[model samples]
Target: KHRWAMYIDVSKCYGCYACVAACAAENNVPIGVFRTWIERHVTKGGTVIFVPKQCNHCENAPCVKACPTGATYKRTEDGLVLVNDDLCIGCGACIQACPYGARFFNPVKGVVDKCTFCEHRIYQGKLPACVETCPTGARVFGDLNDPESPVSQLVKKMPTSRLKEWTGAEPMIFYRDLPSEADL
Candidate 1:
């Protein structure tokens, strides 16, 4: 079984927003909402840091538990946090539960929506939209179970950090060389 994970090398990112555009286009994301977005932080020393934000696909997802209708759930096979449009009630519980602010109610569909790591494309042997369009190759995706996978190898070599680690969601997105402080 392949456990999917994403590794981001922040040092390689240049805040081009190419990944953001690519993700929106590929996912058909609506305006005023983002399946993936980038946050720019300027340190005290004036160095700019770009932190790309998306669904963490948490191992202990609060959104999954908060969804009253069981619309939000994590896949046991690959740990992808997915929304079932049929089951969603637009209650906004998932949105409120998510600390990462990665989900939203799609008014067009009357259901909650969020990032799935482009699992459809992954099944077709393609990278996620964000990863594919990253000009600097800052994004990496692979099976964490595979020792030779880039994500796995990066975790071994890099000092990685996850967003809100104290919350214990066990976020699968790992960042290398990330700024210690992230601003919205």
Candidate 2:
């Protein structure tokens, strides 16, 4: 009954790329590809902000619907969108369907891969590598269904935005303190 979610304080991110490096090491992501990455945006007024990007783990994920096989799925328990390597054909259908550009074909695994919010670590009662490694504490993760959880509290208290809301993917990743001028 847990709906896991992440809240990113965009203003806190300092473009250190620690989260990016942690994600790559923890997830074994190949070179030249990333499960999570950072985007640096400068406003017209000359303010810079770093936005961390990854799978939104949408409630209505287009990647799940686009999969020819049942490789891509959303876990009902925690709302984690995942890929089953055994079922994956690397057809790239899911990649094309994702408006966020979160998926990629893994040459090492020969299957589609993406961020799972570090499900393996989370189930072990640990934070996602990105969240744990973030020097500025920009990322917060927890069960959104829990009223007392940090993620839920932040979402309730702050003005937040999700990317590509027009696509209706219902992305779970929320951005706090996102500047309006920063191009998403």
Candidate 3:
């Protein structure tokens, strides 16, 4: 069983929006909806910080709880939160339940949509498009079950925090050197 996780070094992000563009293209995300996005935080001192936001793929996902049907669920094998489009009722509960504001109702598909860590590519032994295209290598993905994985190794050495940690969703996305202002 591969417990997957992502490591994002906030210091490395350049706010190029390359990851954002790549994710949208790879996932075929409809216009006005995004599977991944970058948030810019500008301090009064003129310092700018870029934080990449996406589905946390939470361990105790509120979206899964909010769904009237079992459309939103987490994969036990990889710990990835996923949606069953056929089971979706187009209800906005999942979207509202998400504290990170990562879920969206895709008008084109008539179902709730969000990031899946690009599992389509992961299962094929390829990295997610966003991770592959990031020029600064800010984002890293790996199986946390493997101690030798880069994400695991980095996490052991870095001071990592999850977005909205107080929510107790147990988000799998870990951040290093994140700015104080960036919450999600």
**Backbone clash tally for model 2?**
0
Residue range 55-156, candidate 1, lDDT tens digits: 988999999999888878899988898998888878998899998999987777778899999999999999999999998989999989999999999898
**Candidate 2 lDDT, tens digit per residue, 30-70?**
99999999888887779888899999999999999999998
User: What value of lDDT does candidate 1 attain over all alpha carbons?
Assistant: 0.88
Clash counts for the predictions, in order: 0, 0, 0
Q: Which candidate, 2 or 3, would have the higher lDDT against the true structure?
A: 2
Q: Tell me the lDDT of model 2 at 119.
A: 95
Candidate 3 lDDT over 1-184, as tens digits, reads: 9988999998899899999899989999998999999999985567898999899899999999999899999988889999999999998999999999999989889888999999999999999999999999999999899999999999988899999989999999999987778974
Q: Can you rank all candidates by TM-score, best first?
A: 2, 3, 1
Which 10-residue window in model 1 sums to the lowest lDDT? Answer: 175-184
Q: Which stretches in model 1 have alpha-carbon errors above 4 Å?
A: none
TM-score to true structure, per model: 0.96, 0.97, 0.97
RMSD to the native, candidate 3? 1.1
lDDT (CA) per prediction? 0.88, 0.92, 0.92
The pairs that clash in candidate 2 are: none
